[model samples]
Structure formats: C-alpha cells, structure tokens
Target: MESLGIQHFGAFVLACIALALTPGLDTFYILARSGREGRTVGMAAVLGINAGCIVHTLAAVLGISAILMTSALAFAALKYLGAAYLVWVGLRMLLARQSARQPTVTRGRGLSAAFRQGMLTNVLNPKVALFFLAFLPQFVSMQAPHPQWGLAVLGVSFIGVGMLWSMVLAMLGGQVHRLLDARPHLGQWMDRACGTVLLGFGIRLAMQRQQ
Candidate 1:
C-alpha cells in the first residue's frame, strides 16, 4: 500500500464502510429485490452492482470519467437515461398484476434479470462516474508511483466493503419476504412501496446538477 502511495489506509476503509452502511439507491435496490424475489436474486443484484462499480473504477483509471465531469451534454444524457430506466422499472413494479396463484421466490431468469437491472441502474448514473473521479483520489498520494493502480485498489476496496453490506441487506430482506410470504397482499404492498421510492429516486437523480 505504501509503495502505491496510498495514504490513510485505515481511514479509507472506515470511510468506505460508512458509505456502504449508509442507505442509498444500491441499498434500496438490493432490498427491493430480496423482499420481492429471494435471497439468491438479491445476491445476484449485489454482484451486478459491484460489477458496475468495477466499470466505473476502470473508467476512472482510463480517464473516461473525466468526460462526464467536463461535458455537460454527456453527463445529462447519461443522467436522463438512468432516470428513465429507473422510472420504467418503478412503473412496472407499481403496475404489476398480482397472480391468482401463490407467489414464490423467483429463480432462473429472474436472477439474471435482477442482475441486469442492478448493473444498468449503477452504470447509467453519471453521478457515480463523477463520484469515482472525485472521491477515490482523496486517499491516493499525488506523488504515487502508480496513481492509476492506487485508484483501482481503493475502488476495489470500497466495492468489497459495499458488497459485504449489500449481502447483509439481501439476507434481511429475504427474511422479511419469508415472514410476509403467507400474506400475499402484504408483499404486493411492499412492492408498491419500493416502487414508489424508486420513482422518487429517479426524479431526484434527474433534477440533480453537477457539482
């Protein structure tokens, strides 16, 4: 770590842990999936989100994230796309038709769909790219031997912490789902509630300005 010019390693870990614990879109998304589907699908969403973070980390290393930071058009385009996608997902959930059959935990294609949704949600948000560009450098020494590698390490560490937290959320959500499984209407209510939050998050993302 010293060779790579990373400073305040302990502090960085703590910050990452704190951020992971904080409720955010990722947390909501994972919980929604777990509560609606099952733990397996929720874990899939967690992996997808981490994969998206990896993409952002690579963009930071390659300086692609700089375009989002510098170009308003590019940023807005991604922001709108992300907002639209979120709204679409939210609407689907809100408008979902309850089946006559008893609802069970989703599997198979559902897992893949959850993963894709998580990845797209993370990837389309331009703020996340900007965040990596802005946040990761704080712990990296400007005089580091390999600044790019330093960023990668820090990014991976952050994602690792986040994954751990996300897994816990998935488990908790799953337990909630299990408890509410017998009450199908309650699950529907949970779906609607989650959908409403997602819609609000989308609108907030659309209204946010670059800082």
Candidate 2:
C-alpha cells in the first residue's frame, strides 16, 4: 500500500501516532485550553494548530524550511518571535483574574481567539519547521520519481494523527475540569500551573540552540 513514494507507510504512521502520544508543548496547550474553557474551544484550537502544521508541510515541500536550516539569522528570528509570543501568552494567563461567577472571553470570541492563539503558537515555532524538514526526508523513498509528494503525504499523516490526539486531550481535559468545577479556586490554581508551564516552555524554547 505504498503511494506517493512513501516507503514503510505503516511504520511511518505508527511513528506518527507515537510522537503524537508523547507529551509535549502541544499537549499541554490543548489540555490547558480544554480545562480552562471547554472541549469545543480546545477542538477549535486543534484545528488552528493543524492549520499551522499544514503551513510547515507546505514549507517543507517548497524548500522553504531548508532556509531555516541554512540561514542562522532566519532561524534565530523565528525562534525569538515564537518564544516572545509564548511568554506573552503565559504572562497574560498568570495575570488574569476570574471569579467563579465571571466567565472569561465570551463563547464566540473565545473560539476565534483560541483558534488564532493555537495557530500562532504553532506557526511561530521554528523547531516544528525544522522537524518537518529533517523528519520527512527519512521516510521518503530514495528511488522515488518525485520525493516531494512523499514528504507531503508523510506530513499530512503526522498532522492528522496529532489532531486526533489533541481532540482526545481536549475531551479528557474537559472531563477533568468538570470533576473539579465545584472548587473555583482549584480552577484558578490550574490556570496558574498551566501558566507557569507555558512560561517555562517559552524560556526553554528561547534557550534552545539550532542543531
């Protein structure tokens, strides 16, 4: 069942599922949104994140991602921009004040905001672009007529797996939030914890060197 010059298609998909299952920044971000808001918003965020992944896939196919690997300045600029955005989002979360009686961001607005935030959080990360550039090549058939199609297929497969995992995280987070809903302060504490983690991720990303 090989298509688009993709070798070991089954293995590639399995690898993608494993990667998606691994706990990373994306997992935390989706869970946080689900816990704080609802599953719907979290799913919206998932869509946005997938959209960003699509951008990376296109970049990989078009050789744009190669620029990040070859150009240190371009890599550094994107890295810093992503880190700054993460830090800003973290700060906003940490500084936010919401009572049990008060809701944060109306439903409609929140959905759009979540989508944008998720997209930006993903699109700005240079690491993802680099990962796509490096990872896709390994699975492509060396003897393929057109290697780019294989890259695109692999990229889409990975993104699809990741989106499904994120949806699961959203549902689970929502359930957990429901269980803890009685304690308003607990929700606040949860936000603080998520904020701290997000802040830490930003710092870590900022400190990361191009490898």
Candidate 3:
C-alpha cells in the first residue's frame, strides 16, 4: 500500500530526523538519566516521554491543540505554563547536590518513577503540544480527503523519529558513563550541563510567539 503521509515524504522524514538529532532539552534529559543511571532508566524515560507525546497527539485529535494555535490568549497561557515548568525542572536539577559517582537507581523507585517523571515533564511542557499543532499540519495536503488523518500520520511519525534518536543517545550516554566510571566528577558535570540546557530552553520558549 502507498504511504499515507506528508507530501515530499523524503523531505519530511529528513526534517524530523534532523530535528530529533539536534541536541535539545529532551536529548539532555535522556542523556542525564541514562548516563548517570543506566540504559534501563533511559529506556524508561524514553517510554514515558513517548507516552506523553501520545497524550499530545490525542489532544490534537480532540481539537484542543487547534484552539491554542488559533487563540492568542490560549497560546500565551500554555506557552507561559510550559516555560515555567521547564524552568522549574531546570532549577531543581541545578539545586540538587552534584554527585561525583554514577547515580544508582533506587530499588523501589526505579523505572516507574523515571517513567512518571518523564511523562509529566513532557506533558507539562505545552511547547510539545504546540509544536505538534504547528508542525504536523504543514506536511498534510489540503487536497487530502481527511486532513486530520494526515495530521495523525505525521504526528506519529514525528514521535517515531524522536524515539529512534533518543534510543541511540541513551545507548551512547550509557557508554560514556562506563568510560567515565573512574571519574566521579563527570557525573556532576552532566547534571550541571543538563540543568543549563533546560534553563535555556525554558527561556527560549517563553520568548516564542504563536506563529
């Protein structure tokens, strides 16, 4: 069967991959967890993130995302909320004491906790929802009988691209952890770096317009 997706399918996939590869808040968060904790934790985080993305996709299907895009006030409200959440997460990371050694996952609070945090982190950032609202529709063809179906295809594809990239980063981070196992301070550096990146993203998001 023919693909049910964006026009210029090759270009769209390439763009999605490029966006995924560009190291941003998501990448940093994945790296921080996987590098410090292990691949398992990173996988959990990835799953959680995708879970959150799924929710956004559902919201888009429900027309909630469209409302934000169309209404300036709604857009602003969500944008600020997302910005605040990102900044808050960043601040928490910065304030936490740095550990010289690789962090260990708490036995009881392992994958589930990481997963929940990742889900919340993604869901709270209205930017993700907005991003889907703006980005997916562009690839869809106006001539298509069901533009909403096209949107779904593109949104799911975007999530798939992101997941693939995150998986690679997670493994790479785990490798780095093993390499730097002897140097405890490296873990501390990772925390600081992640915190800094998150803060920067928050600031940037706050400044963005709905366009």
Candidate 4:
C-alpha cells in the first residue's frame, strides 16, 4: 500500500506539472495584467489564484465537485456565473482610460485588488472545478485503497504545481511590464489584448455543454 501510494503521488506530480504548464484563461489573464500592471499586481494575482485553488481542493475533498458534475442545473448555474464574471472583467478593462502623462504607481493598494481579481477569475470558473472532479478521481484506485485520501493529496499537489507555474508567469510578465511601461500606447494595447482574450473565453465558456 505504501509503494502504491508513492507511485500514485509521483504520477500525480507529473500530471499536475503538465496541467500547470498548459496555457489557459488564467494564465493569459495573469500574464497580460502583469505586463501592464507590474510585478506587484502580478504576484497578487498569483496569490489570488492560489487561494482559489485551495477552494477547488476543498470542493474536491468534500465531494461538492461531484455534485456539481452530476447535476445539470448546478453545473449550468456555475457555468453562467463564470461566464458572466469573465465578461464583466473584460468590460471593466475596456472602459479603463489611463493617461500617459499620469505617473505610474507600481506600489499601491492595487495588489490586493489584483489578488481578489485573480481569486474570482479562478473560483468562478466551473470548468476548473469540473476538471478537478474528473481528473483527480481518475488517479485514485477505489478498490485498492482509501480513494478520498488519494484524491485529497492529488488535489493539493495540483494547487501547489499551479502556484509555482503562476509565479513564473508573473515574473516574466513583470519583466515585460518594465519594458513596456515607458510606452503608454503599448500598455493600452496590452490591456485591449487581455480584454479581448477574456471576452472570448467568457463566450466560449457560455457555449460549453452543461454535461
């Protein structure tokens, strides 16, 4: 049993790393925002994402994710909520008008706001919850052992891997932000690009099948 658990843990680590590396809506949003807002905001976003991952882990452990996966109404409700949140974020970005002459505030209460944004971005996405529901269970051997414990460990591993990946992304985005800060037009373009990507994701999420 110990050997099996070790093997399962190893496989779970590999899978979590792969998932973390894969580009997703969260990645794009964080990268773009970090490039525009600076490392402080980017790190805040990463922290928020970690917080959301904790929620996902908890949901998986508590079987809430299974309820969401099996119930069409619950899934649809969450799906729409996620979609709406993304669209709202995009709209907010589109409406923002920052002047080039205004001094850039790299350090402010903005980090907290960015962190909250990151949390919402992940927490609202039903697909992420569903992904955990489906993916984590596949790793647990129901007949061989304690499936719940296996799932819990795998879920926590995924969150840890995701946080590591997001931090790397945030650092990269910060570098880009430094390069682009001198060019307000470039910053504006980045904002627009992020808004577009977010809007697209929201639309795509809305079109997803409830099942």
TM-scores, all candidates, are 0.95, 0.93, 0.82, 0.89
Candidate 3 lDDT tens digits, 1-211 = 0144458767789999899988767787788777767788888889898899988988886678878768999878878887887787677666677446534322136688768878877886667888887777667775666667777777788899999988898898788768657677766666667777888888998998877
Residue 194 deviation, candidate 2, in Å?
A: 1.3
Residue lDDT tens for model 4, 1-211: 3423334667778888988898998799789768878877898899998898889878987889888878988888888998998888786666567775443332244788788878988888888888888887777776645667777777777888888899899999999988886776776666667777888889999999856
Query: How much is the lDDT of residue 132 in candidate 1?
Result: 92
C-alpha lDDT of all candidate models, in order: 0.87, 0.85, 0.76, 0.79
Off by over 4 Å in 3: 1-6, 98-109
lDDT of 2 by residue, 1-211 (tens): 2556778888888899999999988898888888778788888888989999999999999999999999999999999999999998887777678784466432236788888989999999999999999998888875777888888888988998999899999998888767656666677677678778888989998999998
The residue pairs in collision within model 4 are none
Q: Each model's number of backbone clashes?
A: 0, 0, 1, 0
- Order of models, best lDDT first: 1, 2, 4, 3
- How well is each residue in 1-211 modelled by candidate 1, as lDDT tens digits? 9888788999999999998988899999998888778788899999999999999999998899999988999999999999999988888777676652445223235789889989999999999999999999999997977888999899999999999999999999899768767677787677778778989989999998977
Candidate 4, superposed: residue stretches over 4 Å from native: 1-7, 102-109, 144-146
Candidate closest to the true structure, highest lDDT:
1
- Evaluated at residue 206, the lDDT of candidate 3 is 90
2 or 3, greater by TM-score: 2
